[model samples]
Target: MKGTNYPNRWLIALAGIVMQICLGTVYGWSVFTKPLMAAHNWSNSEVTLTFTIAIGCLAISSAAGGYILDTKGARIVATIGGILFGLGTLITGYGDQIGSLTVIYIGYGLVCGLGLGFGYITPIATLVKWFPDKRGLITGLAVMGFGLGSLMLTMLSPGMIASMGTAMTFYIFGGIFLVAVTGAAQLMVEPPVDYVPAGWMSPIGKKSSDGMTLGQAVGSKYFYLLWTMLFLNITAGIALISQASPMAQELMPSTMSVGEKAMQAGVILGLFAIVNGLGRLLWASVSDKIGRRTVFIILFSTQAVAFYFLAGTKDMMMFTIICSYIYACYGGGFSTMPAYAADIFGTKYVGRIYGWMLTAWGAAGIMGPMLFSRIRQASGNYSEALIITAVGLAIALVLPLLAVPSKAKSKDAKVA
Candidate 1:
């Protein structure tokens, strides 16, 4: 497979990168919020709801998309996702012009969100198959693009808004995303039979504790433990992300210009994207060496400390570092879980099983932001919300230690 004649492994990784770039643009939501609010004279809560709706749609669509990817292959699933996402954004731009927040929510939230869900899963299973030996690293690299995609957009969207206005910016991004993703989708193909890359040991042949099939994996104690961990991790991260701008205001109130504030927010979000992207690869690759369980323990435990510090820190430098570390943990969690799933369950049905697991993220998506936002609204401060998030992370640290890999036998177990 590494014959240097259009290396298929790299090609597949490239496709994963492209797919993630499109998905990451949505992660750049914070960059758009101020502009959207200033232009439409809408309240903060109303604008924030759009993100909530989009995240909910992403969660539902991801589950469905996983099932489809298992059956239909990457090309079809991604192509359709691109088309839907593009159309959704096009309509969202029109909705923006007319000041129809409802239309924007439905189009960008539901339609584009579905596209993100569908597109997000295709690369995971494909990359797993492509580099069975380096599953963690490959998976991390692919998903890291999703995190970095926002960095690219964060840099571009502001200039685009300045030059072309927000509505036209959407149209431009919608078209560019459609073309890039569609082209990348075309490059994706399933791995061939008995395909083990050069010098790579097959995971199937490894002797370890017995594992479960996808079905049994879902039924095991450890599966739920992993799910709980993910839920806590996501909840903490989303709580911070959803309230970042407002939190900045409270911490630095009356000292910064509007332009300075916007710049600060953009810098924070951009750093989150960069750190998050780096974390996906960094932690996942580390897992390959130290084992997934150790990494999870470190991630959750460190994040608990970070979140606590984030709530108390008033210094800009300290605040930025803490926020970046938190973002890294969030992104690392997303990348690590699939490989973790493979470690516990055999990879035969990983696509479908991982999809099912992502529902935890979906649940957290709803709970995290709402919890923090509502608490902030009620108390006029985020200190309590931060404390709650820190507690959740601490709890997550313990769940992984309790998880014992499933010992059930399955028909698929004999194939290796």
Candidate 2:
């Protein structure tokens, strides 16, 4: 592995960032919740269910995308992802035009979710191969686009909706995503098969090599432990995310008009996005220095404290600040987990292995909010949900301790 072309490979990262920015619009779903509720008379639970479905589909599709990425390569998988995502968005617009909840579920929840899964996997695994020397930092840089993507759309979507109405907003965004994602996909090709950095060494250890296929990886005890830990962390993080806009409004000090509340909540969402992006970069870079496992332990411990007190936050600004911390830890998981997976399983089949691991995220998306939604509905407060999430995070802290080292043979026995 020599003669690495530094300039061109960075272009792949640029394309990845562009692609992720488009796919990240889903994080802005909270902005649309009230509009859907007013339009269709749907309950909060029904509306939030779409988020659950979307992530679940994303998890499933990502698994398939990983397999395709490993076997078929990144370009085709990304292209297909773009097409599916754009089409799903377009059809979601159709659902909005007709004011049909079921249609929204199918188009936005299931279809577009599939696109996110495939689109997400491409850059992550590709960059791990391209930038083996900077796994944590490069992965962080590539995914920071995903975190800020929510901010971009949060700022943009409100204006689009006001000018064009909710239905047309989807149409325009769909067109943009189609063009942007396809263009990015063209640049997502794999690097030279035997490439390595100009001045670098294997990170985990001198003898560490890329390990096991998906089958073998699943068989390892570390897999289940890591998966459970990931699941708990994401569940707590996503609870706030799925409910952010409304929660922000509720936490405000005094009674206000709907417009004012919406405006302030939007600002909070923007803050979350900014912090989320920064967390990806900041924490991932930290992982490179202190190591991935250590970073996760830190992530779990910090979030556990935040979640416990979040239930008691009364001031709007303080609420945003605390939730931002939780969101940052959430973003850290996205950045840290890939690097960690590569370290453990070898980068040989990291796309697939990490995709499987993301099942925890998907599961959390589906079930994590149940407690919050139910608790909020019954008690008219998020305190119980916060306490429960905190407890979950504390439990997750133990998983890292139980992660016993296990190895499987790779084709080259080289850890990526």
Scored by lDDT, the top model is 2
lDDT of each: 0.78, 0.83
lDDT of 2 at 190: 74
The alpha-carbon lDDT assigned to residue 111 of candidate 2 equals 91
lDDT of 2 at 247: 89
Candidate with top TM-score is 2
lDDT (Cα, tens digit) per residue for candidate 1, span 1-416: 45534346887898888888787787787677788888999876777777777778877877787777778777888887788788888888888889999999988888888888778878887788777778789889998999998888777777777778889989988898888887788877766545667776554554322335567867777778888878888878877777776676556657787556766677677878899899999988887787777788898899989988877888877888898999898889888888777766755666677777777877877787788778877887788888888887887767767764443222222111
* lDDT tens readout by residue for model 2, 1-416: 55435548888999999998889788888888877887788888888888889999999999999999999999999999999899999999999899888999998999999999999999998988888878888889877888988898788776677677889999998999999998899988876655666666664443333557999989988788778877887888788888999888776656787656766677779889989888988888898787666777888888889988888888777887898888888888888778777877777888889888888878988877666787888998888888888877777777766653634222212221
Candidate 1 — which pairs collide? none
